[model samples]
Target: MSEQAGSPLEDLTAGGPAIDAFELLANETRLAILVTLWESYRPFAEDTTLQFSELRERVGTADSGQFNYHLDRLTDHFVDATDDGYRLSDAGLTVVRSVIAGTGIEERTLEPTTVDMDCKLCGSPAEIAYEDGWVYVFCTECDGLWTDRSDDERGQLARFSLHPAALADRTPEEIYAAAWLTTYQKLHSMIEGVCPTCSGPIERSVVVCEDHEDDGICGNCGRNGRGAARLSCAVCKEWVQSTLGSIAKYHPAVVGFCYRHGLELQYGVESLAQIERRLDEATSKVDLVSETPPRVDVTTEMDGDEIRVRLAEDLTVLEVSERTA
Candidate 1:
């Protein structure tokens, strides 16, 4: 195949040499400058940029030559220098915001506390906890959603990524709500063929456990269900895996079915509990109709009417059957 004229490939070749951006950020001064610019920027203000001397003072660097040397290293890539002053470039803001989001900054943990919702696997009240930038849920009674195959004693119903900033001045219930909302938004984006990390295109596929056994967590496959959808970003290589039934809630057929039953598929701190129960109630059945070609049916019910979403081996919608009871 020949390269198309004026392709994005041209832009990559235009740059003289491949530059390692991380190499320029090795010095503490450059990171401080980025953090300072991020702090000083105000969208509405006329002068969001900070003058060289003022920025140096804010960063507490006494030597002007040393500071300027570091600033010059980051100028074109991370910092934008205008006639008036300097401000963070798009890349600069990304670095600072990632730090603010608790990425690789520190490790924090929250002790287990009973949440308002009951476990979907077992009817026991679910307990929520936070550890290393993730919110985890576990059932007090059953094997939860998945148990570590190596250690049968420990298990978690679900775990979602959440930043440490969300933990401040919030109750355990509030934290769980934030995690749930974040997970829903990210998963929805991924399902629509978008990568949550880099905004790049995502590739999705379905995988079925051939030798599956479900006695709560499925000792053979280590999956609560037989089939799961796996998504990978073509650009960033970020991977996300979830049971096919969980992603079915985003289907228009399921949403419409739940709305007809007086349940809205939505989420907020106040509505998180309601949405959890409503989704669980509507999607009460998941059956693996075939294992050879890897087909699964995620069924949602309302007022005795059932909508079965049949997914193919790659998780594409093969058929949607509505059965009236």
Candidate 2:
């Protein structure tokens, strides 16, 4: 196809070079400057600029030439140069926040506890622990951790620590499971006109299965498939994708169903053919509401009893009905 006049592709292909951005961030001093500006200007007066001397004092760098060199490198990319002095550019704040989330926090181990679930391989009690901000559920008898050994620990830890209150008073297994569910729920909520992350508008869509044909398994949990839902925050650009089943576990109707059937919604349950058979028998329909901001409605029926759940775009329970068949 021929390129059109003033096409968006022109702007996308007009960048000086992609590596130039990374090259700017390669220096320790430049990164420190961004972090320093981010800390001073955030949460209250992000638009507030700092004088060069004020910023330099906060950074604790005695050498003016060295600091200026680093600051100039960030200009027009991460740092915005102004007559008042300097402030973090939008891109600068993003880089600094990412760095803080990635490596700025201190690592510590939380108190370990035994959970209610047992190992699928050995039938022994499962143990849950938190270390370096990542929750771990493991079976001592089987030496099996819920996560894969080769996954990126940094990204995992960052995601968990994003919402610390969600982790409180929860076992490792619960935390691990809830982390995915809660984020899924929040992302769904964003799609439904409320954002749990930033109270911003959200956009959501069903991911084409063919687009992810190569992703046959999750590298982190070793789950055998990808999720269908894809949600993006219009303001924050936060995005999440997870299976309907995984996200649905948090629904009131699903929770009630699990309680009524004495079935636990955890990792190993789906792998068991008997449990899958039971779930299949109980679940009558998983319907996706076809609207601009879509909803997922799930129905379950068993032994003359039935429950219908209507979920908002963000997966929040909008309506739930229980009836006897």
User: Each prediction's Cα lDDT score?
Assistant: 0.79, 0.60
- Sequence-dependent TM-score of model 1: 0.87
**Candidate 1 lDDT tens digits, 1-325:** 5667897566545644233475677688988999899999887788899999999999999999999999999899989999999999887887788788885445567898897888776578888888878788878887776654353354688888888887877799888888877877778889888898789998888887788786667777777877788888999787777878767777888778777777777544246677577647776577888887877889888788988898887667888878888
* Candidate 2 to native Cα RMSD, angstroms: 10.0
The deviation in Å at residue 223 for candidate 1 is: 1.8
Candidate 2 lDDT over 1-325, as tens digits, reads: 7778798667556755556787798887887788788877856753678889988898888999999988888889998999888998888887776666555345435565675555544567655566664555556554332235455331111133334444556555556565545554565575466667567777765432222222433444343332255567788776765555545555656667766766554434323243434444554456656555666666676666777776665565678888875
Off by over 4 Å in 2: 1-17, 62-66, 109-112, 115-126, 131-134, 138-182, 185-243, 246-298, 301-324
Candidate 1 regions exceeding 4 Å error are 1-19, 43-46, 103-107, 149-154, 267-270
Candidate maximizing TM-score? 1
